[model samples]
Target: MMSFNATLRLAACLSGALFVNAACADQLDDIKKAGKIRIAVAMGTPLFSYLDEKLQPIGSDVETAALLAKDLGVQFEMVSVTNAARIPTLQANKADIVVADLSITPEREKVIDFSRPYAALTIIVAAPKGTVVKDYADLNGKKVGLTRATVNDTMTTQLAKGAEIQRYEDDATLITSVVTGQVDAFSSTPSNLGEVMKRAPQKNWERKFDQKDFLLGIALNKEQPRLKAWINTWVEAKLKDGTLGAIYKKYHGRDLPANVVQL
Candidate 1:
């Protein structure tokens, strides 16, 4: 009993509803169809993703993401961004996910979403071999150099505000400052500081700290709830399967401490 005009209006309404459904899309499906899971990782050595002798990328984060892509049924693609640009990169849709060592902070929570953290990396103090900075007590008034964008600055300053805190642009510079006697010690996460120690111009230079701080998380935009859920679920599965611990040991050369908690 509908007239021609009524039929046309009904068809248009149905098409509009379809368009609305399409607009509120599922990014996971899009990624799978593209056949690759892209990642935004901070550039560095031995800690996150890094370049190897063969000029191929290799590291804990890199290998872990590749495995995650395999589990997700897609190829892995990595893009480098800095700490400052990390959130912006995700917000701008420059990367599908962020696997860098993103510390979960309440301030950051307002704009970005984070996956359940699978790893904990807090800052500690590094001293050259034979330097007696074995604990917080030994750092009363020493000079400490810390890399920016890490938990180091606050940790160092809080433990001993009497001590001088100098922030650097990168890990290499902070380590160099400690090595060259420009600073009494350096501070950064275990992975970064450990990597610097491993490649120190001399052997046996290392850090000492009694307490750890925060766990790192995979940051995403507020809209990517599905991606956040996927990473959290995937990380939990890896931990249960022992693949998570195995991969960390393979790169870090030790087991994760039992006391270290994941979120």
Candidate 2:
């Protein structure tokens, strides 16, 4: 027969185990139980998420999402989105997080929560091969295409106050309009320009302008402090281990921003 002392010991062990399980389970639980985290990103190539020639999703953001999921101990699900709609998507519950090339502006921060700035980006004007669009001055009285509802669209208008502005829902359409002679030139983010150049290297588009934007950020529900805190910490850890720099090289083929070391 078992002694009474042994029975008490067994019960205490079980109680402690239950408390440990409860304590160890929080954000980690929400992710696993849901099976996937909705990650928002643009569906393109080179810098952000994109399909390779073989149709595999390959980009710095995609890779980063995969690694983040691994670190969080959950599966990752990507939600293809546009620069204009990313915030609404998160706010509307269409996506759980925004991992796109989202710039953290004070205006944007008023509506959404953001992770620590990841990278600094710039906006530029790119023209097709042999076109005369050179700089902002050249764009005067010219027709320029930009992505609708993007920061670039507004900046383009301000820079080319006298120029005709054409707006599209996304980068692909805007670039297409420029490619097919529908517009004189296209103005967009440099990371996106890099993707366009990779897709059509023979076009030999020259960047006539550059607008240095503040750091990029990841978006989450404003109330999700736990998840937001975790992402912020995760980004810091990646920076610590050189993973951020390595990821940048894998996609952009170079080092990070001058301020990355400080990040």
Candidate 3:
């Protein structure tokens, strides 16, 4: 027994919800019709997404995105992005999916949906072998290099007491700063550090300690439930078949760590 105004309001809300659902479905349909999936991946992230000697994009993220598009029976068009561009590209409808090392967190979940984790990351502190960084506590009062606005930066800023943090635009710059003694040590994930080691094993950097575990996922627009579900299924199947592990080893030169998040 609702009043007329209340009944009208409820009907309007329901209509609006239905319209929204219809619009989302249309977007997905358009992508299928186009026969291509635009994947946004982070640029200059070595071992994740970076240009190889041939000036071609070749990295774990790039390969993974290409695989996904192939599975979808569409062409893969890569959209090079930056760390901050991850969500905006999807929000602006400029990309169909973002495979840019996006970590699933409660804060980000409010704006976008994430597929099941495709990779896991462990941040660590690295310094020259003889450096006195035996543990996180030893980082206090020392200069630590990190990429600005990354999870490593946030974790080090929070946990390493009194450490003077020098933020760089990318890991390449941070690695240079670390080697040149601009920073006492560098806080980074293993993927980035592996690239550094390959380029300069003579540096003799040692891992001081591990920082945190982060699960990386494919980020989708919040309204695209169908796309998200498809990606989750795709990831699960690939993980079971060892496709993902092979990709990790291809770029990283080591088997996928056993610490990866289980699907």
Candidate 4:
């Protein structure tokens, strides 16, 4: 027979293996038990997730997350996060899902799983009027501002290879940079630029080029495959019933392009 100590050590190793396997295994069960779904969202991006005059979280992502929790029969808990923090929040177990305008990409997929895309994003290059910036090639040697570490930044770096790409921490700073001429122009989503114009109304700024359209999805922990599958089904239902576009139009002031509406 095995010695008492050896048997105890073997049992401990087996238990440790089981514990490792069980980590993040009960994601759905834990959320249901807690009666709330915590969603991490960008707090400064207008039309996506931002504070209203009342300082309440109010935007498309906020509304979408609320509806998601409602369908799941749970309370909606909003956790403000930044562009760089979206995936990390989910990884740290601080948020159950991320609705922070996270674009699905091959690189990010290696870190976290994504729900079927629930929305689409169009990135644009905008410059001051009379700037003569007609296209990405025109950005070369010009100072262009964009949110650091965003897809916009990534694309700008690729397209404007010779440009002086200035990175800011958030949208507010990026808008300020363009308005103050801190940079020659800024790269951002049209919705964000529209919101900035509503507040700043710098008519001198105009879009120079349409960068690309990307699919946006909710980010979740890779360990939660069941939760990911459930969210994908939920997103499909929302898209079919026009719920997603309705919310998008309510915040964005335009209908979601039909081409970018489906999975």
lDDT of 4 by residue, 5-33 (tens): 43444454446755444443458778998
| Most accurate candidate by lDDT | 4
lDDT for each residue of candidate 1 in 96-192, tens digit (9 for 90 to 100): 8888777788777887877777666666677777889877768767777776666556566777776777877556566566656688777776776
Clashes of 1: 0
Q: Write the per-residue lDDT of candidate 2 for residues 7-39, one digit (tens) a residue.
A: 444344446765455333444357768988888
Give the local distance difference test score of model 2: 0.73
Clashing pairs in 4: none
* Model with the higher TM-score, candidate 1 or 4: 4
Runs in model 1 lying further than 4 Å from the true structure = 1-24, 129-142, 157-160, 201-204, 259-263
- Summarize candidate 3's per-residue lDDT along 46-153 as a digit string, tens digits: 788888899999889999999999999889999987776788898898998899887777777787778888886778898878887877789888999998767887
C-alpha TM-scores of all predictions: 0.77, 0.81, 0.84, 0.87
- Alpha carbon lDDT of each predicted model: 0.70, 0.73, 0.79, 0.81
Give candidate 3's whole-model lDDT: 0.79
- What C-alpha root-mean-square deviation, in Å, does candidate 1 show against the real structure? 8.4
lDDT of 4 at 91: 91
Candidate 3 residue 241 Cα shift, in angstroms, is 1.9
Off by over 4 Å in 2: 1-29, 128-137, 191-204
